[model samples]
Target: MSPNRALQRNISFYDATNPQEALGGVVQNGSITEANFLDILGILLVVDGVSPLRAQGRMSNHIVSRRDVPLKTGVYNIYCDASIQISNEPWIQRLVSRFAYREKDTFRREISNRDRKCVISGIVNPESSIQAGNWAGFKAAHIFPLEREGHWIQYDYGRWITDMDDAPRSSKISSSQNGILLLAHVHQVFQQYLISVNPDDGYKVVVFDLDRFGLDGKILDPLCRSPDDPHHASDELLRWHFRQSVLANMRGAGEPIFEHDFPPETDMVGEILAGHYGQERFDLDITDRLR
Candidate 1:
């Protein structure tokens, strides 16, 4: 559960030898332009900042495989290799925010104020407050959650993905634009669905839901609707619900879904801060600064 495990980063390579190569690299086909080149390099910079630099010198990194490149006038060629690079920057921030002192609480407040509903659920419980639960708080759910580990600190998913398999797709956890706040139950339910939503407009999005019972109440039903639109339950939310219910269909599977504590409920942030700063220092009382 330590953030040490969740930190991930990597850099990928692509062959620009032909149009097909560009398509495979980013799922797009076009004449590589200066802007596109900068975009690629910009992403590379992020990867380099987090991943180890290697001198390929023309050797293929072998991240991706061969793909098709089509040109105008009925011309097609396959002359480049598709590869991916990833890093664990955003993932680490998520872990830190989940476990960091003061950061978690403050983040929750910010998100709660934005959508008013629990990020995990579309409903906002009037009883929810920071002084109610362990810290008198409602849950500030992760759009992309941070799974647990040994001591329940904060683990990075990007790190896991990179280590388990070298891929360009990196884990996104922070980017305030990507999070939501929900009541505790709603948060639990959202976690159950393995899907999250945008309060402004219900967008059906997928998440790696790792729970047995889903957020809405029962096992997921792919034919159901998305949790979006508090008014009518959006299709996106329904799809997510169904997918999660199906995911929980482990009647014959060996690897059952695992359960662990998430933020607001667990004492991970408290423990991590207490261990780092000592309980005495953590409990210290302070006054105003500008006197």
Candidate 2:
């Protein structure tokens, strides 16, 4: 760790035993005094730099909703409107030395180059503004996971990538071609297969029952919408992801509890409603209002 790390950077570390559960301890309750925040980090971490600028930036940028302010900042107030996320900064060179891969990898940067921002949200800029020096908040999620059941490449899930019969498998199963670049929240839904892209149609999204998963279907962009983007997600990985989603959402009777998406007419109604109100709300239900 650097001398003034917490003062200048947002460092996210992983519990290598389980990267899925990593960084849950990130303090989302706004900034705290350096003393109250000391004991929460892992034993190997050194936590002492909750200075004004870091807290101010985290507050003004990453905070979702303003609440009771625990730490006193006489000059500036930190209020976050989006889900708290770690951004890159000059002061961010600290970590578990061995877990450097947790930092945005070459795979993620390549995906980001292709996808730009969260395809669904339609926001071109990050909340804090993408400073020339800072990294993006988008996460690169692997369609075929590298780890499962605390083991890598050894189990049934691993077999799906290595040994599936009908679908062609990628030689580099963990490459950028086997991934999707998504916002943090979208990544969460994508992780569960609540959101997916149709392999047949120009990669248009087919969200499976948004209501059941606490998400709403939106016009999500595929990885290869542009004319000249060299990299694109592999059909094999996407097929695997979609299959896993079906398995994940299937009921005990071996059937999906809900259908894949709203009908095209329903979407037409949604579009009409959105245009009429001059606002694109996802859950504008024609059935509920009966107008």
Candidate 3:
């Protein structure tokens, strides 16, 4: 199906107390207005994907409420439904990575030093291995994607990086405060927005896609969230990512899931220009490539 068509389906909401009574449908563009109770409920209900059976189950078990939605003022407990399959489209990945490109040595070194293990999984990299300069199976994942540097700059998101000295005010996208050490595979799912950490919810790990790694509902590592730790990841950045994940996976039919494995000789530029957000993606790609 086309990306636009895949995102046009309606997301319905029903009363949890009486599942038979319909509350309403999601607003246009799948945005759930914060002020509207039903809209908030609808976002909570469908953010994890459109599964009537699961939605019904949650309501039946009182796992979610209709009249008294327990969501905090700005906190959201959202995830993409496991059923919304991710696509194997490598061009989109290339385009996004191009925008994310920067001098990696500093960011990677600082993040790896601070977070010696995957923050979510707690898989520690041995000190000996690190001394040998072997950082296999782990990566520094950005909380606010580097691809969205334009958004970051426009909003002055660099102000949130209080932990870093000499951090670039123009773009703190590569700062350790905006990064988390994650297992390589976990990093992929994170970059895809299929999983995210909800800092407002005590940094609980929320999975929008299938829980293949059993990471759903896990709390973020304390080592990374300790208040005394100057290098802790930014709560603002985490919240931003959580919100982005909600918009990407819960809105409408959910954002297209693009794969990241591009074979050699693939016409990545052509594919990106032909896909959703084509012009924006192409422009970002070109601008970043030029730099």
Candidate 4:
């Protein structure tokens, strides 16, 4: 099946110290020790949905080239060990892998799990009412969207740099603490504010502008909500990312802004929706297929 190479991660060995490092060059000399190879194989199975033996088999030549005894069975052992370690703390690994695969749905789920409601309005609705039955208030937002070139290779003094062209594509979905959960409407407003108010800062979305616009974009102080909310601050690194990738479009007026979370409590999707609103977190009762 074409070696099922498509299912393998593109991580490199050089950046292996971190869980989210690229896997492209990491499978050095087309090889890894039997133990390490097994670890990789298992990781592929668990993280990418590949069969354990099949994943190892794909790396047969590489393992043979680099190690003395590169058996798929041995490799499977290593793969299992790595899978256990990764499963214990999966957010980072999941983020890295999701970014690597451009699994947009995974990205949305991760963010939703972390912060389930829209901070803009503070209203939590049922998941069914949120994104037209997607989630109460969850949508996949690109810290550095593929539509725009949002990928980073490494950090330079607590800042991410886009130097790794080969590695850049692997980082498409690496989650940053700087990223935020907003209603789709607020997400759109945040982008518009990026172009109109903070063009100087580049295309990255920032809390400062949204905090200024509030949920509905009435130009009220956006930070009127809890200032201590971790998402309230600007992320310099993400801004740098946007600056590198976001192309300024000095074109027609953008979409309308959702300027008011007047109800004072809302979910991400509720913020996008309009009409008489209330404060309640519904059960969503969504089917598995919807999730």
- In terms of lDDT, the best-performing candidate is 3
| Model 2 pairs in collision | 63-80
Model 3 C-alpha lDDT per residue in residues 1-291, reported as the tens digit of each score: 233312332344443444453333322221122223333343344333454322332323322334323222221222233332222222222233524545388889988888889999888999999999888888888777666677778878998888655767755677878888899889877877767787866687766665678887688998776778887899998887776665565544556665335568988777777877777767776777776
Give the Å error, residue 87, model 1.
24
> Model-by-model lDDT, in order?
0.31, 0.39, 0.61, 0.32
Error of 4 at 57 (Å): 72
lDDT score at residue 93, model 4, on the 0-100 scale: 7
Return model 2's CA RMSD, one decimal: 23.2
RMSD of every candidate to native, in Å, equals 16.8, 23.2, 9.5, 21.2
| RMSD from true fold, candidate 4 | 21.2
TM-scores for every candidate against the unseen true structure: 0.29, 0.40, 0.69, 0.30
Q: In model 3, which regions exceed 4 Å deviation?
A: 1-63, 66-103, 164-168
User: Per-residue error at 108 for model 3, in Å?
Assistant: 1.1
Tens digits of per-residue lDDT, candidate 2, 1-291, equal 112112221223332333343232221222233332222221213233432222232233432123323434222222223222222111100111111124236667666666666665554545355455244566666665433222223333334332234443333445555666677656656654556654533454544432343233334465434434435666655665654443332211112122223455555444434442323222323222321
Full ranking by TM-score: 3, 2, 4, 1
lDDT against true structure, model 2: 0.39
Tell me the tens digit of each residue's lDDT in model 4 across 1-291. 001211222332211233343232221222224444443333322343432332223334243223434333211112222332222211110011111223256556655655556544454546565456456434444444332222132322223322223433445334423344566655554443332122222221223122334332222123312246543323443444333212211011111222333344645345423321212111111111133
